[model samples]
Target: MNDVSMPYETHGRTGQKSRTRTALVTAAREMVANGQTPTVDRAASAASVSRATAYRYFPNHASLLAAAHPETGTQSLLGDDPPDDPAARLDIVIRAFTTLIVETETQQRTMLRLSLEAQDAAPDHAPLPLRQGRAIGWITEALEPLRGQLTDEGLHRLVLAIRSATGIEALVWLTDMAGLSRDEAVDLMRGSARALLASALPV
Candidate 1:
């Protein structure tokens, strides 16, 4: 059997496509980091790529920004050898999630602002990245051990409640409206997540 039958040309072509996609996304991310809500054309200009090429890659500002979103793919907040206790597991998840928010605070705020504008411009607009279920999936995974104890409805409700207390929305309110420092906000989220777990599971 020929293990290399896939051919170098195919590999090279795939690699090129990956690089092009990365370039477009990187341009959008850098523009977002600078506090500019960029159109697909602007990202193309920043990437030194043609607008047509960029459009082929991202299609619209929403899709472009979605790919560029800082929290777009944060799948696992858990560590190697994660604790089996749901409360402890959730604490670890909250701590890691809050750390991400602090590090990408600027980018998160930009995405949030754009999400608001999109919501206003069209009530049925495409979902912004942060509003997608990435965090929910991760949190659910962390709390998987509780499945036996919780009905599906109960588990879902608990996830939503914890999500409401954590994540970027909570950070914005805690820091901007409540005037807590970044560290203070993180601590508060961790505490809230642990408390929620305890109440829900009652071990």
Candidate 2:
């Protein structure tokens, strides 16, 4: 809610305060990774920084948790050696994406929950990460070879289908309710992505 679209700037902070803030964010991330929603006080205690200073850094739980979300800043899921084939490229992307989701499952789930709750609370104006379109860009890049093959609208639809079939929400349901092992969930996620791609661009 706090104008997250604005560039994340850690300006106007002295050395000590900046250190304190870093410590607090690190503590919050650790708690989030361990399946706990952290509070300013808890993070402060964890960091050995005073609660007052922690409050100064993150005034609300949402702000702290949002900050805890991993900032990949990556444009493509492909590794240094990427394939030229569209399906193979997308498969690489899905594999890397699912691996990261499994590694940071707890934090990803927390971010998804916050985004959902925020949207449910107010249908209009969903903020950071969710509305940011980072995954969309990555998926689009992965399917870049299909750009000329399919119409723009068709390609967009395919991208959305892949996005819907993967991510934290699917990860949560796959592991939590569906009772799939981590490897099983990743396998299904990759399979769904490839199936969707094949449907769009048949062999």
Candidate 3:
């Protein structure tokens, strides 16, 4: 008896389809980076594949957008450890987030655009502040030790301050608006984050 479980035709077609999908996704990402709004047909053409192939991989615009936006579904920069020393942990978290923002500048900008569009299209859509609050919550946890020193209101203010001081908006302003290089922007952000943390959560 022959093993009929493995459908050779389907298996071969699936492998080909997977490669084509990867190509289309890559093409879409490049197109987005180049300031083009990639459609299924456009992405397929860019990838040198068929529109049907692109549709097979990305059923809709949302799927393509999700793929093109790499920052989506990423874990917190702070990682697993919620440090016992709140102040130290805050510094670490801020540093990590700043580093990410600086490194993935284009992706950060794209995220900001997507967020604004989402909010405009649907007022109930999750706000960027709420999305950022996850990181801020980690920062707040890190500042737990200093909770006694600072009031709840003060802590909240400090969290907003730190986030504003080190976020991609600042980075964009410095880099694009102010014409600073990526290295210069990152260094500025690092300095600002450190200064804010030091002043707000003094050891």
Candidate 4:
């Protein structure tokens, strides 16, 4: 019978490629966290993979960046069944957003840098706005009962405020720039969100 193990060489190559792709992503994230630009060669070396292997998965800078930053899609901390009460739902979303920011610090920073770089290279490539929309959609749905209380402009302002308060920009400022510990920063964000909601929403 023909030997199935004969293709060991091909299997080894596939395994190496998978390892290289993982390494490249890890290295790229680290570079962004350290405030350094992540180039293909640097990422390859950091991942312990050859430059050629890195190119095989990510043909160009844009492709590599896009691969590194993926949206969480429909998986949100606030489950599909939103709370029946508007205020309770808002609380859930605010807490979820705050937790997400604190927990995904490294990934958040990498995404922020990737977004800015992509915007500079090609304004149309920016994905931050789309991501922001997803967050706002959650907030709006939760606050549907208070729809009449908030004007369109007011709602927009609220979304912008929340986004600004919970993203990488805030994380970096609180942690690196302002010298707050991760826990402290997260607590501060949670408080800020609560304060905003209390002030913005009607009684």
Kindly list the per-residue Cα lDDT of model 4 for residues 1-203, writing each as its tens digit: 11111232246576665555667777876776676667788888888888886777666675555445433343354677777776677778777776776666777776677667667877776454324455667676666766678898887787678667865688799999999998888788767866787799777
Model 3, C-alpha of 31: deviation from truth (Å): 5.4
Task: Give the alpha-carbon lDDT of every model.
Answer: 0.80, 0.77, 0.68, 0.67
The candidate scoring highest on TM-score is 1
Q: Model 3: residues >4 Å from true position, as ranges?
A: 1-69, 79-83, 117-134
TM-scores, all models, native as reference: 0.89, 0.77, 0.60, 0.62
Give the range of the ten consecutive residues with the poorest summed lDDT in model 3.
1-10
Candidate 1: count the clashes.
0
Candidate 3 residue-wise lDDT, 84-131, digit = tens: 776567667777777777676776687567656767877875444324
Over 4 Å off in model 2, which ranges?
1-21, 39-45, 48-60, 71-75, 128-131
TM-score for candidate 3: 0.60
- State the local distance difference test value for candidate 2: 0.77
